[model samples]
Target chain A: MNLRILIDRFACRFSAFLSVCCVALLALIAVGLIYKSWPILLEHSLSELLFSTIWSPMKGKFGFLSFIISTFQITIFSLLIAFPICLLSATYLVELAPRSILKIVLPLIDILAGVPSVIYGIWGVLMIVPCIRDHIAPFFGYTTSGYCILTGSLVLAIMVVPVMMHLLIQVLQAVPHELRDSTLSLGATHWQMIKLVVWRKCLPGIMATTILGISKAIGETIAVLMVVGNVVQIPKNLFESGYPLPALIANNYGEMLSIPQYDAALMFAALILLAVILFFNMASAYILKRVTKSIT
Target chain B: MMKHKYFKKLEEQFFFGLMQLATVTILFGLLFILFTILWKGIPNLSWEMISQKPQGGFYMGGGGGILNAICGSLLLGLGSTILGLLLSIPIVIWLNIYAGQYSRNAVMVRTALDMLWGIPSIVFGAFGFIIMLALGIKASLLAGIVTLTLLILPIMVRGMDEVIKTIPKELHESTLSLGATRWEMATRVILRKALPGIVTATLLGFGRAIGDAAAVMFTAGFTDNIPQKLTDPVASLPLSIFFQLGSPFEIVRGRAYAAALVLTIIILVISFLSRLITAKYQKHSR
Candidate 1:
């Protein structure tokens, strides 16, 4: 009995130690990135590095303003395109769809969510880019090389739809059936009940889901990199090309070894990306926590 | 009053119509992607492409297969999945069992994992590259596996945590009442009950690891040759597709479709299998 008790205590302690390590891993990553980028931080003012548009690497100038603007443009545009569709689809699935349609749509969402990001990039190249260049751009009386912000946003919108839809469905489903039924029993129509009761209750969760989706979109690299023309300009219009920060790091990391301060500059980009994602995630988590607390 | 009621009804109908249109559009978009991949990929997919290694100048329309990449991806996926599983199980078990579900420590760990999950794979790759630099390691199979482990660790842990959380408090009490220690109860009862879920979680991580391109791009260092040891550079199917699609040759671009088709099919199969497993095991658990 004594031996068994000792073994159990030891096992518990060991697992506890492992759990701490898991938590520590995130902090370690943040510190490591900051440390790696310390040299560049010392060389340039933070304001200049973030806000300046000059990016001549040979002259030791590294302005990240355009990349930041492009990243925000793509993420915000993609969210704008994705949010309404996901909301309506999720509302339909939760409040209106019959079981047969629900069965099919749920699996479709899972499959879409599981499809690799690179496959999306390939599909973007083969379809969206060309369609934009030949048809959409021409229709708008603008010329493009098929790779531009619009193309990137379209691909990203599709990629994030399933994720956002999945979460929204869960959030809407979490609305108490009693509350929805009571609202309907009070002579309110189905649409009114959904609009007033379900949507009102789920507003926090929906916000959290949107924020989480934004974080996911912001961190996306390979697919966006492949579709977005990596021109180093702040896009003046949807038809123009732009470069996002993830693409900046990915496209230049291996080759940055030859240039002084280049690697550190790239690391600084990664740090910025990490900090933004972490902020969004924590904000969402906090909102989600409040939601769960209220529910429980 | 009647006119106002009519307008209200019209608005409801219009919004309902909009919802139906949105659903159809999403469904159509997904189907169009699948259709395009099949239409373009089927003709290009050949036995030779799957069976042999790339010949000289394969990217420039040379005659060779992506066997190196196929093997490399399989090796890396398996390596990272296994490593991720080993690390995540303990963290999850601790979270569910030792830390107690609502404890502050458990909550903190869960939040950390959630943040990690949201961090992009490219960032993980960059971080891993920095770690490799610090450790005096090179871009190789080992490096790629380590980076991918970080990428998938949160996924696997969260997957298992969701399952383990569903195990009732009554089960825990009953196991303890029978004089089983916490560790033994975790292994014998909790692990047994969650086996199907654990398998599904592992498969999910494996799929993510295999399909990811950016996280492995820098750490894995592309090579045409298959890696024979952990230190050797390796190739992957996603990178293969990326490189092949970027090629100017029509023949090479077709192979990219073929590769994409293979990857898509693998992911679909894994998702399908996990669903089947959950359905099968759910009968016994309840």
Candidate 2:
């Protein structure tokens, strides 16, 4: 009995020791990523990295404002197109669909979430781009040469729908059935109840999903790279070539040699992305916190 | 009042139709995207294409099959998965049982793990790059394995912890009262209860590792030929797909599509199997 008891005590201590170690390792990674990334900014200076007008690496220029502009422009464009569609999708799934169809549809959406970005990129290149240029562009006064912010954003909108739907569907499903009942009882029509009662309660969650979706859209690299027509110069209108920060890193990080500074510029670009992602995460977290507290 | 009710019913129908359309629009949008990938990828698929290596220029039909990549993906996925579980299990067990003693810094531990997920994969790539450079294993498969272990560790730990924590306290107490040693009790009682959960976590980890490209791409580097040594650079299917997709050669791009189609099929199978195991466990419990 004593021997067994002693063994148990030792095991308890061992487990405790291991947890601290894992936590410490994660802490170390966070610290190392930030510290090593310092070399990029130290070499290029923050102002040059952030404020310069052009970002041609071959000429030793490394301004990234245009990339930032493109990222936002594409993201904003994507959100505008994808957000409303996703909200309606969530509404349909949570409120409108019968149980039979709901079971089949939900897994289908989840599977899309797990599909690799590269496949999307492949499809965008082989199928979507050519179709857009040949079919959709001519109708809108666009020539065969046109595949830019609009086309890329449309793909991103498709991508972001799964992400946004995941969040919106969960929150919307969790909404109280009693709330719907009370609204219906109060002489509110189904559509009016959704707009007024269902949506008002879920306004915060929908906003949070929007923020989160934008984050996913902004950080995406492969799909955007395939279709973004990634010229370094700033884009004009929806038809011009441009690059976002992630695409810039992916495209240049491998090819840049002899110039360590250019490599660091990629790191600097990454840091900018790190900042943008964190900013979006904080926004989503903030909205989530506010909603969770206010909902009750 | 009755007249007003009739108009209100008409108004509800009008809005309901629009809302229903909006719902159907996005749902179909998802469907069309899936159809697009399947349509483009499936026609190009062939068993021979998946089993060969890249050899000739784009069209001469082969130097390397995806065999090396398939092998590497399995090795890397399974290898990192095993390493991560070995590394994380001890930590999760220790934290749930003992970490309350440190109490004040417990929150820090939690924050650090949570922050691990938030850090972008690029930063992980950079960190792994630095580590490999320091170890003189620069851009090797070991670097890829080590980097991915870190990447997948958090999910593994959380998954395991959430499972282990659910084992009833009475189960542990009863085993200990019978004079079983800590390891025996853990192996016999606690872990027995947590096994399915642990397996579920491992499968999820595998899925992430297999599908992941960016962090692996940076750490693993890309190669057309297979690695002869652990130190040699190797290509993954994702990177191979990325490389071939933009190439001017139709054959190379087609091969890339074939490879992707195979991968998608593999992942679907694995995910289905994993979900089945987890769902079965849930059913048994209920």
Candidate 3:
């Protein structure tokens, strides 16, 4: 009995130690990224690094304008594609679908969410990319290969739908049933009640879902890399090929060691990626806080 | 009155139709993907494909199989899942057991984890690469495992925390009133209560770790052979699909689908099983 007690005491301390490590790891990563990126920041002015548009790492000219723009362009375009579909489906799940249907449909969505990104990339390569190249791009009069901004955005939209829809479903489910009941009692139709009551009530959360979806879209690496033609330029139109931030880092990080300051520059790009994701997440958190406050 | 009623019914029907269409699209997309992967992948799959490492010229109508990637992915996934659990379980316990439910510290930690969960896998990969350079560690299984551990830690912590949160406060108090230490109460009561959830958390982390290509792409260098040591470079199933799909040969492209089919089926099974486990435990808790 004494030995068992002693073992428990040791286990407690060990667990506490591990818990502390969990908190420390985040700080360690931040410090390491900043430390690695310092050299690039030192060599170039902030505007020059962020806005110069020319990203010839061979010539030591590092500008992230094109990539950053591409990232936003792809993200925004994908969100535009996903927003209505996700919103409507989420509303359907919460308001229209019977419990029996939901039990099956919800699990299917969950299963889709767990599919790996690489699998999506493979699907994009085999199916979506060709459809874009052969059918869609030709209609748009895109003369070159089918890899372009539109292809990446379309693929990304498909990937983000499950995530955004799941979040929206949660937000919609959180709406007080009393609100819907009261609205319906006031001679409002079911559709009218959902639009004026549930939708209005959860607007902040809905907005936050958009931000969260954008964060996911921006951070997507493999699927974006496979379809986005990876040209280091700001695309002229939706049909033109361009590189996004994550794809750039993945494509070139391996060969970074061979060039001067290239590794540091890539680290800087990563830091930018990290910062954008963090910024969006913080914004979403802030919005969610307001949402709960408004509900109460 | 009749005209207004007709318009109202039409509006409702239109919106409902749109919502149903959206749901159908999502379901159809998922089925199509499954069909395509299985259709393309199953023909290329064989015992020889799964059991033997690739011979030379594997990408060019090759003679060898992807045994190396299969073993390496398992090693990395299992290694990272175990490591992530070591950190995640305690952190979850700290959040739910040690800290009071509504404490400020608990809220802060949860917020940080939410942000971490939102951070992209690519950034984690970059951070791992930086750490590797600092430690003079090359791209190897150890680096991949460490990076993957970090990648999945927040996810496991959050998943287990939610499970722990579902336990009633009365249970904690009753255990404490029995003169048991917090550690004993946690180990004896809470963990037992949350066992199914904890298993689900571990499996979820494992799925994420195994499926991720970006987090391990740089840290775990691809190799044709199975890793014999922690420091050896290793190939992963995701990267194998990636490389194979990028090949010029149609036959190799078929192999990519084969790998994707295997990966997707594994992930699907994990999701289904975890749901089953969670349901089983929910019955007990109720």
> Per-residue alpha-carbon lDDT of model 2 for B1-286, expressed as tens digits?
9998889888877766766787677677767766766776788776666676556563344445666677677777887899998877777666554454136555456545655655556566766876776677867778888888888888788778778877777887788799776578667777777888888888877777776777787788866666777777777877777877767777767777777877787777776877788789889888
Q: Estimate each model's TM-score.
A: 0.99, 0.89, 0.97
Q: Interface RMSD in Å per candidate, to 1 decimal?
A: 0.9, 3.0, 1.7
The count of residue-pair clashes in candidate 3 stands at 0
Task: Judging by lDDT, tell me the better candidate of 1 and 3.
Answer: 1
TM-score of 2: 0.89
CAPRI band of model 1? Answer: high
Per-residue accuracy of model 3 over A1-296 as CA lDDT, tens digit each? 68767866776677666666656776777788889989999999998998989888888899999999999999999999899989998899889999888788777877788889888887777788889889987886777577889889988998998888888998899988888888888999889888888899889989999999999999999999999899988999998898999998999877899999998898899899988998999999999998777757
For model 3, how does the per-residue alpha-carbon lDDT over B118-208 read when each residue is reduced to its tens digit? 9899999999998898899999999999999999999999999988898889999999999887878888899988899899999999999
TM-score-better candidate, 1 vs 2: 1
Best by lDDT: 1
Global CA lDDT of candidate 3, please? Answer: 0.88
Model 2: DockQ vs. true structure: 0.50
For residues B107-171, could you state the per-residue lDDT of candidate 1 as single tens digits?
99998899999999989988999989999999999999999999999999999999999989999
* TM-score of candidate 3 versus the correct structure, residues matched by position: 0.97
Error of 2 at A293 (Å): 4.7
User: Lowest-scoring 10 consecutive residues by lDDT in candidate 3 chain B?
Assistant: B93-102
lDDT of 1 by residue, A1-296 (tens): 59989988998888899888878899999999999999999999999999999998888999999999999999999999999999998898878889799889988898889888999999999999999999999999999999999999999999999899889998888887899878988988788887888899899999999999999999898899999999999999999998999999989977888999999999999999999999999899899889888878
Give Cα distance to truth, residue A283, candidate 2, Å.
3.4
Candidate 2 positional error at A17, Å: 5.5
User: Which ranges of candidate 1 are over 4 A from the true structure?
Assistant: none
| Per-model DockQ | 0.82, 0.50, 0.68
